[model samples]
Target: MGETSKRKRKRNVSLTPEDITKVFEKSMERASADIAKLIEAITGGDAMTRLGVELEGMGLDRMQVIRVAKYFGNKPNQLHIHIWNGLNDSYKPDFVKAILEE
Candidate 1:
């Protein structure tokens, strides 16, 4: 019997921080200002599930899907990361800066 090896498939897609930010923003776009505020109101609830359900419904690409999954796994922490990409420049200083302070 001849030995044979199968090569593992690798994704050609390489997502830069910029690309991640773009995808996260795209996923966020599916959310409205009302929803964002609503998330704030329900802090201890299943915010990640809510966000993930919303992002999952948005039909994000594979990378974005994975990103959202990871973020959802750690809801409150990743909330900053998600909001950093999702929110406007004005709000970025708050959310993005929070991520750094941790």
Candidate 2:
């Protein structure tokens, strides 16, 4: 194993500026799509502006968004669990569905 590790060869390939630009563009596109999906699921039938307004004061990061969705069911509910068990790892839409069902 040590001999094989020492014999490892390096492959050299240089990416041109255009190649870098294309890679960056693809990554940005994917990231944008994912963010859009997350936001869409979180907002659902509600207007994006509403979410923007609520998130304004709260600074709803990913975990906070999950927590709010989990406890609140994307609508007001009376079930108040004050503990953060980190069980709200489900994505926004699933969390909303689970909470509503519960």
Tell me, by TM-score, which candidate is best: 2
The most accurate candidate by lDDT is 1
* lDDT (tens digit, per residue) of candidate 1 on 39-79: 65655345455555555555666666566456445665454
TM for every model, in the order presented, reads: 0.28, 0.38
Evaluate model 1: give its lDDT.
0.56
Which 10 successive residues of model 2 have the least lDDT summed? 77-86
Per-residue C-alpha lDDT of model 2 across residues 1-102, encoded as one tens digit per residue: 586665664335789999999999999999999999886555453443443444434555676555555554444322222122233533444544454455
- What's each prediction's clash count? 0, 0
Q: CA lDDT of each candidate?
A: 0.56, 0.52
What candidate 2 gets wrong by more than 4 Å, as runs, is: 1-10, 45-102
Tell me the alpha-carbon RMSD of every candidate: 20.9, 13.7
